[model samples]
Target: MTKNITTTDFSAVKAADKAQSYLFDNFCELLTRVFMALEEEEWATQAAWDIAFGPSVSDADAAWRLVAFQAETVTAVQPLSVDDLLLHRMAGLMSRAVSATGIDALETVRSRAMHCIAQAPMATAAAVRDMAKEALSTIDQMLEHALVCDGDDMSVRALPLAA
Candidate 1:
């Protein structure tokens, strides 16, 4: 398949420069976990949020993360904010995931991803992958059945297409 390939510079990011966005609130944990599967040229921390959120933070999946800020009551997050790291990370992922499917399909996936929430981000990502595979399988089945039926002829084919 033709792909829109991109590359990244896996360099260290300054903590002060990085920022954060709470992706957890928007997407389900499973779909968000897809990041875990991403080759961590740098995505181990910040996702490609820079580009994804630049147009709008809403463009990201259900981001649930802490930023560099102190709360009135308490502060628990390590290093405060990860937005900088996530920014580049997300930008990279989008680059890789962008396909012949076009922006419309990506938008559809983005909308669906929001419903996914957090537990283990990596595992959640895997679950999202599986869900799409399952959906495509069903589509294949319907298409095969339709082909055999044709127009008003419900005759069974000698060869099994499903196999």
Candidate 2:
């Protein structure tokens, strides 16, 4: 079972805080850049990595964590393939991320997410009743990073559900 945060568990809290900081600082910026580069047809794997991780390249561990998060939240949603056009793949991924938020008007969401990646307060919180609440909660949660525990591992996870 996952342990709840307690004052005595300083290391766990510290790790969670560090993870949150990294997600806040780099994750959003990287997504914005990725979408922008895609729109311009100027995105390259190497270039994206350079731009996103260049400042902290010496921190190999941090870079790897960011890359793993990227894979989970970005590329894994809509992957580039040998036969796929760059623009389409990019749009697919962005759209998928937005849709995962359970928002209506997927095209509009996609357009906005791609064009305005850094916009915040992407979702509104409301009181939901019964089963609907359970469904909507998942959607709402997608917009922000959450520290999740799975067995012995803990990771910061988020999706492009944020504007």
Candidate 3:
């Protein structure tokens, strides 16, 4: 015999799907902001400095900040001798910041964006676009999985009562 579903079950599933969609939308916005920030070399360099070391706290801090900020930003994804000390360090610092924020989805997108930036001498507009597209696609897949789970729950709730 075929089983039947109910409306209550469907409603629950719909609610869960909505929640997942909301999360994905927020994640996408964060990715967009990061992409815009990296579009210009000056902005990217400033971000790198901020990530590496927080705002200067003292007189000595200002000198260190100047040195680090003056260092060249690595454009290539692969490491160069100079990159090993600077860009790689910046990547690690930014990754740590993302992790500390406890937003796994945003962190993942940031990591991917950083990877693309690290590969080239300064991130190109095309590469940024590609990374943004990929990040948005991944968010969609995550939302789909949440929606499927919601649908399954709805089916369970819709079952007929035994008499």
Weakest lDDT window of 10 consecutive positions for candidate 1: 64-73
**Pairs in clash, predicted candidate 2:** none
TM-score of each: 0.21, 0.27, 0.27
Write model 3 residue lDDT over 1-163, tens digit each, in one string.
9988764558866766564444334333444433332233224233554345543322223332332232212212333233232334443333333223233443454565455445544433453344434544433333333334246532221110000
- Candidate 3 segments exceeding 4 Å error: 1-7, 44-133, 136-163
- Please give the lDDT score at residue 82 for candidate 3: 34
Candidate 2 lDDT for residue 19: 51
Residue 121 Cα positional deviation in candidate 3, in Å, after optimal superposition? 32
| TM-score, candidate number 1 | 0.21
Output the number of the lDDT-best candidate.
3
- Residues 1-163, model 2: lDDT tens digits: 9988755658966776565444333434444443443333222233454345543342322433443345344333331222112222333344354434333443343454444322322341121121122222322333322112112132222222232
Instruction: Give the per-residue Cα lDDT of candidate 3 at 89.
Output: 41
For candidate 1, lDDT tens digit of each residue in 43-149?
A: 41245443344412322212211110111001222222332222223322232232213333444434333332222145334533454343233223323333333
Stretches of candidate 1 above 4 Å error?
1-124, 151-163
